[model samples]
Target: SLRINKGMHVDGNWPALGAAAAVAHSLGLTPAQTAQAVQIAACQLPMSLYLPVRSGDTSRNTYLGHSAQLGQSAALAVASGITSPGNAVREYAHVVLSKEPEPFDDTHGFHLLQAYVKPYAAVRHVHYGAWAACMLRPALDPDKIEHVILDVYEEAVIYCGNRAPQTPLQAQFSLSFGLAAMLGWGRLDPWVYREPQFQDAMLRALEAKVQVQVDASWTQQQMRGARLRIECSDGSRYEQEITAVPGDAQMPFTERELVDKFLGYCEASMPLDSARLWARQLLVAPTNTHPFPFWNLPQEKTPC
Candidate 1:
């Protein structure tokens, strides 16, 4: 799937569809009406193309407001306990599609590259890119090293550079920030995107030291990876190239690894036992045959 921007799910569009589905269940719309409500949400979605990394920008509003919220409103307007379905879809359609359309630009290709990495490409690349720099960090002495040279695919150069990232979202999207985070701190984890770590002055300085260059050969090959080469004042060099981003469909995490990953994410919020139970429930939810309102709904509402 060509999941542009933050993806239909990550940007809250899929949830909007789910919210609409919930309302559809309560109201018992005909299969045709239910289908229409879903189509309205899907068509009304303002595709996120060239979004600024800065979260404070008004452009970010489309991500939060357009698809998910509209879907929710459409479903509620037609539900039994809500307003009449009369003209509701039409009213919502006019409101939804009325916005000025987003433009097609160079950033659209970056979104495709991001989706190629899948699940968590932004996080994974930043994590490993930083790791590659960290591996070279120990070999260098400040007095002996010159600036670091980062060779990445064209998409990486476009997607990750030439920005001042003030928020986690910005940092998450930044390749320079990732390299700096790894070189300066030897790590780029979730916490690196948060508080004091993100704002570390030295890290910011290192970010400026990173020079990203596009490798046309890699771009031609349609590879999603990066190579970091460090040149010392003494003329020595260290280099590593990452050709396959982790979680890529071609080389996916094992089922057990995925479970462990789920447990890891859940452990942050819930007790280990509870996390395991939650993971199990989510894993098995699809196979469940009972007429539970949420799960029993047809899968037709799901975005492609």
Candidate 2:
């Protein structure tokens, strides 16, 4: 019952929501009930609305969190004889895709596939900047990196280039900060999101090197494109251009890599063995199981 589009990145809590909905549907829950469960699941998800977006914040990020909880809630409501819009997902999809008028097509091919995932847990726009920063690392010593020129799609600058980041959370949304971390550390990882890293002198100097330029030809269809150029004090120059960031379906992570990432994020919170066991089960389980003991673990111990 757990149906997923091929080549999609099931990041954040999306996999959990999909599994819960499939299990509910398989247990004879009506479509309306299933829809209610999904809504409830989405409502319970944690929200991160502070991430900036072009012109204004789009509800895409917040909606996904809500959609997960909503799915669960819809499923439970149906099981308990509650009623909801029979075409819940259809309607919701219409809203997100900017469909006009009532009676939207359920088969209209909503382009959820266009959504991208973050390989580095930072703002989506910052991914290319991070990629660029990492590429320049070997050529330029952190102390010698004099400046960075970030040539990105116009939308990226507007959304991710706000005032200087004053908090770790804010830094995640800053192109300059992300690039600085990449230049100074030779990579961007969860550890780079810490307070000390955010306040480092070398990072600030690298941040000063960051600059943005708008690419007029870019379009929504070309969301993943970015270009970076770096200059070092010893007359060394490094540059890289990526049409699409890594972790997209075109450049998917290997199964082992994905599993490693999942486990790495969960091990500290959950029993490492249990998390590994459940992740294996999820990959090949014939049918979705009941709330396995694995699913009932304490919230702090749950695998992301």
lDDT (10s digit) by residue, model 1, range 1-304: 1223322223534446555665566567775556556555554454454355544244554665665577766665554334433343344335544433343254535444444323332445454466567668887664455678788777665555545578776777778888777677665556577678778888787777778888899889977677888877788988887776546655666667667766655655679987776666666755654433476556876422
For 1-304, candidate 2 gives per-residue lDDT tens digits of 1211222222333444564467577667766555566655443333333333322344434555555554555565657676544444444334433453345336756457655456786877888878876765776778877767888886667557754677665676678888788878866667776667768877887787788777766744555567888778899888988776677767776778778777767755789898888788777766766336856555784221
TM-scores across all candidates?
0.58, 0.64
Candidate 2 least-lDDT 10 residues: 1-10
Q: How many residue pairs clash in each candidate?
A: 0, 26
Candidate 2 RMSD computed on C-alpha atoms after optimal superposition onto the true structure: 7.9
Evaluated at residue 220, the lDDT of candidate 1 is 98
